[model samples]
Target: MTSPALTKDAIRAKALELGFDAVGFAPATLDPKHGERLHAYLDDGRHGTMAWMESRAEQRISPDALWPDARTVIVLGTNYGPRTDPTAIHALKDRAAISVYAQGKDYHDVVKKRLKALGRWMVEELACQIKVFVDTAPVMEKPLAQMAGIGWQGKHTNVVSREFGSWLFLGEVFTTLDLEPDRAEVDHCGTCTACLDACPTGAITPYQMDARKCISYLTIEHKGTLDPDLMAAMGNHVYGCDDCLAACPWTKFTKLHTEPNFLPRVELTAPRLADLAALDDTEFRQVFAGSPIKRTRRNPMVRNVLIAIGNSKARRLKEVAEALSEDLNESVRETARWALQRLEKP
Candidate 1:
């Protein structure tokens, strides 16, 4: 009832034809060393308040544990490299610096659509069972991507490609087909500490990250109020941070991504801190509709915007911070007070 098994080359060609920039096959099972590293990271409490990492440890470390029937993993990368310097917004003190990844339509929506297309192809052609995943799953995508030879996890702990640098969005398809695995990529980050040195909050060391101190984690994931020190270091990054990713030397080989869905939206690329800080729940939802920033919601986003306003030291925005000092959300109110105090300082 099924067509004959397709060659790895055929699948790779199909993925490219579907607009994926990188494709490779890897065994569904992960190397034990990778699992060990994850255990150690979780043990050290480096994941911050992301409790799912602890709860989902078993499924995340082993693909077999997640889906025992999976024999081959098809790793796919879509390029979302920025057309301009992503770090340039920092110099414009009043504007919020959103991470390059969040500047457009949500990647989960964009990447998953392609993954399902690829999955449907495999089912129709080989009659194989397949499961597709993007970041919505607990799969260790960066490690699996390295195993698939698409790229290696660099010193910053994000996968870096020779072709796309730090700009690839990873997704995977786990299937019953036993395709030949590609040679695992070796680390190309020798002696490079650019990502470490570039981190304003020192969240990274050689190849490890402490999410508690990461600006991206603080701005996007952490709930409630933030530490004053971390808030001060956040600069104008209101949604997500990109300093470490933008600092990678591997990015010299980066080419602008052609995907229109991943292109930066004009407003998100240079959102004014004052405008963002003033957004009500409904306004926030409307403005960030269809964007990743929508998940962040209003209170936390306003909290982050307040921190950026505090760091701005532009006394003109002091009244903006004061206006939110009595916000209904305790966290927003506290952050607004902090911003007001910081702005009042010399």
Candidate 2:
């Protein structure tokens, strides 16, 4: 294997050729205060049911701990911006709002494959040892991307690139290759409270997020019964919520995704709550076959639909709620009972 010295520009070109929207490099080092802040956030019970987050405390802060030989951290961003505001479905109150990210194929598989291809190309061309990650490991990808100059961590705590907005999914290539690092982007979220105020559950606070109060966690990561207070506030969001990400001013620069797999499915886009409420296990698997929504399985999804039907102003969904009252899943049954009560009142 011939060792050709790899420059950051050369790597960026290869990344573009490989279909990544943005690429940036950073030294494999930990942010001094990030660990402390993360610990504080966890200590406050902010991570909710995500026990995995607390388990990998050291690796989350130090990239070197993940792979000691990694000299350069190449952060890649793939944009998944929708053609329209995902929140537009809210007006159709009888429909369930799926987060834009989950409306398409799971990004984990899509991004990891691309990163592996890029890594293989790098190994063959530059003779570098590399490992790829796409939200799979303990890597604190957002801060690393910010440090690498791919983007800045906006008030919403997600990476926001000037070129791609907040709609980009982050992936990383940890390599032994020595590469020049890019200058970090300066924070551009000054005076912007749109995302903070837009959160239905008020999950965002400065640079922090309380996952316990986040709809994404409640509907996805959370198992068993949900807090009555938060469930009532969930509105029609059946899966993940994107209120913060969608409210960012930086999204003005967002463009339609080039990946065909990311295009919203007709059935998923503002899916009628009544239809979702009717999904048995088999139908649920078939409908969400290639979608990220499959992660929630049938029970939680039905539970979410019940919550949405309860909140709906559509009289038609009242029967849907009543029908789900005897759902096999206890959680779904309880939520359905609540929905039935709400629908019966008015």
Candidate 3:
């Protein structure tokens, strides 16, 4: 007697039932062509201070190289599209322009918990070896996502879905099950420079990104004083920037995510720059307890607030910027000096 096989449709159904917005599968044997691109990007020093991306370049490009036993890779997408226009805060100079993705609970916790649920289900039903990965791993999720038909990597270098637009949070599950793969999505962004023209720092060049000039990198991963030109271009974005992502035309199709955990907290939407600048380490930790902003630390965050105030030309924040000018951290003080100069300009 022949038993029924575990089908791709069945796996996808289960994944969707588990609350993953979109799901697709691809062979673990993804093409290694991206490895060459990674080397070129790193060699040009385009990655800037993100040395970790360079350190794990090998495991990042080649899925088979990362895990030999993996035969199928299940790629998942969770939409974190904003309930409101992400760009609206820019006009409110006194408020911070936090990236929409970070305005809610951390996706790592949301997606990883869901991945574990799906993985455990597969292990019991199909009896396959499995591994789950969030962004913590060296996985090239964007390329792998393109391979799995989740979406095409758009001009901004983010996976853009026609359905969810540029708001998908990606996760991957590696399994020994040899399920049929989905057909890859072709590049749909034809002659559209919306994301490119919209970048405040011009980080996106056609399909390639210069992470050195990227505002997200500047405000997040970057550890020291921002370049003078980059600081001027940063505007009021304190934690991360989303100009490119919000500019994608496909975002019109995106809907507000219904998951309670993914919903934006009221305070993160457009927090007062003065309030943020006043946050001590203890207060900062308490306010951003489960938030991704906590990783940016006190000094850099304060540095950003001062810069935003300087750019706003609000006389009130001059005192705040003045106080931060003598901050203990050299980077913070450097930014504070720049802010003071911007404010002091006649």
Q: Estimate each model's TM-score.
A: 0.98, 0.96, 0.97
Q: Candidate 1 lDDT, tens digit per residue, 1-346?
A: 2322456877888899999999988999988887899999999999999998989999999888899999999999999989898898899998998999998999999899999999999899777899999987989999899989999999899999999999999999999997788999999998989999999998998889999999889988899999999889889999888899899999999989999998888899898899998899999999999999999999999999999999999999998999999999999999999999999999
lDDT of each: 0.92, 0.86, 0.87
Name the lDDT value of residue 12 in candidate 3: 83
Best by lDDT: 1
Pick the winner on TM-score between candidates 2 and 3: 3
Clashing pairs in 1: none
Model 2 weakest lDDT span, ten residues long: 1-10
Residues 53-105, candidate 2, lDDT per residue (tens digit)?
99998788888988999999999999998988988888888889999998888
Rank the candidate models, highest lDDT first. Answer: 1, 3, 2
After superposing candidate 3, which stretches have Cα over 4 Å from the reference?
1-6
Against the correct fold, how does model 1 do in TM-score? 0.98
- lDDT per residue as tens, model 3, 148-257: 99999999999999899999999999998877788899999999999999999889899999989898888888887878888888889998888998889999999778
User: Where does the lowest 10-residue lDDT sum fall in candidate 3?
Assistant: 1-10
Q: Is candidate 1 or candidate 3 better by lDDT?
A: 1
